[model samples]
Target: MDRIISLFSSSALLLFILVVQNTSSVYGNAEGDALYALKKQLKDPNNVLQSWDPTLVNPCTWYHVTCNNYNSVTRVELGNAGLSGQLVSQLGQLSNLQYLEMYGNNITGIIPNAIGNLTNLVSLDLYLNRLHGRIPTALGNLQKLRYLRLNNNILTGTIPFSLTTITTLQVLDVSSNRLRGYVPRNGSFAFFTPRSFANNPNLEFPPDAPVAPAPAPLSS
Candidate 1:
């Protein structure tokens, strides 16, 4: 009778442990699935994304993907990997993502508004791509954004005034795009120079703004 009771207790403990493990696995798999969705849309000719296996419980082990202590994705470093194709909206599902580095690729298509959901984002580097369409005003939601580099794309339309509200912005390079309209010269824009809007022939500086003289030559 004693032996039977001990066996039953052991079995119950084992079942409890399995249940906990499975619950955590399910949460991790959701993020993994979101990344896998992006993989399907991209053309990875060099097999850079070969390690992105959906069967894995978490994407932390995947190449070019970084995760925190709790296994939540924090950074995705896949710049210049020769990837092309449209970005999927599911990328916004990475709730904990902080750094999204996908610059210097042949990626085309408009910037997805879903990206605005990444409120924790610190840097959004999509420069040197073939992306077009107006800059989404929804990006104003990223209060923590410090570096927003969307230059060298085929983007059009006026720069969203809402972008000037991000006080934490330290570096903004929207140069070389097809952006139009008057550049905001107030708030965070006050710190930027004409060079930030250079090469965008349609964009104009404030009409009454004073012209800055060329810097004096440095003493030899």
Candidate 2:
């Protein structure tokens, strides 16, 4: 009787472990799927993303991907890897993502509004790219964002006033873009300087600004 009872207890424990592992696997697969979608969109000449195998149960084991103790993706460090191509909206699925550093590449296309879904994001660096189109107001949703750099791109349209509401923002750089309209010098923007808006001739300061500089003449 003791032998039968011990076998039953062990079986139950094994079943419980399998169930827990399967649940975590499913969750990890969702993140992996999101990443694989991006992999399909990119032109990785250097095969930097070659290790992103879909058959893997967890993305944490993949290169350039990082995860927390719970196996949820937290960072994707693929900066300056000679990658060119566009970013897909599926990137927003990384719920635990904090740092998205994909700068100094030839990535072109509009910044996906879906990126605003990463409320936990702390840094978003897309500098030195060929991305164009209006900056999405949805970015205002990132309440925790600290560093927001969109410089050296061919982006057009006015800077979104919604960016002024992020109280936690520390480093704001929109320089060297084709942006237009007045710079927001209030709210969290009070900490920034004109250097942040340099090279954007169309971006001006309001006359009421304490040290209002004359708006530059637009270059033909």
Candidate 3:
């Protein structure tokens, strides 16, 4: 009886291990598919994304992609790769993503609101692109965001008030865009200066304090 009980216990342990492994594999495959969808929409003139193979079970081995120990994608650094075309909404599927550095590319089109789903995101660097359209209000969902640089783009429309909710935000550069309307002075925005919104011809600057006039009548 002792021998039979020991054998049953071992079998149960093995089955548990197999279930855990299978679960990890399923999650990793989902992340890979999301990234592959992005690669399909891009114009990779330099073949930098050649290593992205959908047949693979995980994208952790792909170039410019980083994954956590659990095989979940954590970062995607494809900055200045000369990649054009619009960003894919599937990128929001990377739940573990921390840094998304795709700046300095020729990418165009409206910023996808789906990106707001990256709750773990720390830095969102999509600056220096040809992207145009309103800043997505959904970005406010990223409570962990620190560096939000969308500067040097042709983006239009008012700055989303939702952004002010990110108290963790530190470096915000939306300069050189076509953005308009009131820049929120509450919360984290109160720390930012006019330079952060500089070169936007239509954007209303924070009202400067009135200057005192000289006593010209006393001199006369």
Q: Please give the ranking of all candidate structures by TM-score, highest first, separated by commas.
A: 3, 1, 2
Total residue pair clashes for candidate 2: 0
Model 3, 43-65: lDDT tens digits are 99999999999999999999999
- Candidate 1 weakest lDDT stretch, 10 residues: 205-214
Question: Could you give the C-alpha RMSD of every candidate to the true structure, in order shown?
Answer: 3.2, 5.1, 5.4
Top TM-score prediction, candidate number: 3
Candidate 1 positional error at 19, Å: 6.7
Candidate 2 global CA lDDT score:
0.93
List lDDT for all candidates, in order: 0.92, 0.93, 0.93
Give stretches of model 2 more than 4 Å off. 1-19, 212-220
Instruction: List the candidate 3 regions with Cα displacement exceeding 4 Å.
Output: 1-4, 208-220
Deviation from native of the Cα of residue 160 in model 3, angstroms? 1.1
lDDT: the better of candidates 1 and 3:
3
Q: After superposition, how far is residue 129 of candidate 3 from its true place, in Å?
A: 1.0
- Give the Cα error of residue 130 in candidate 3, in Å: 1.6
- At residue 171, candidate 2 shows an lDDT of 96
* Candidate 1: pairs in clash: none
List the lowest-lDDT window of 10 residues for candidate 3: 206-215
Ranking by lDDT: 3, 2, 1
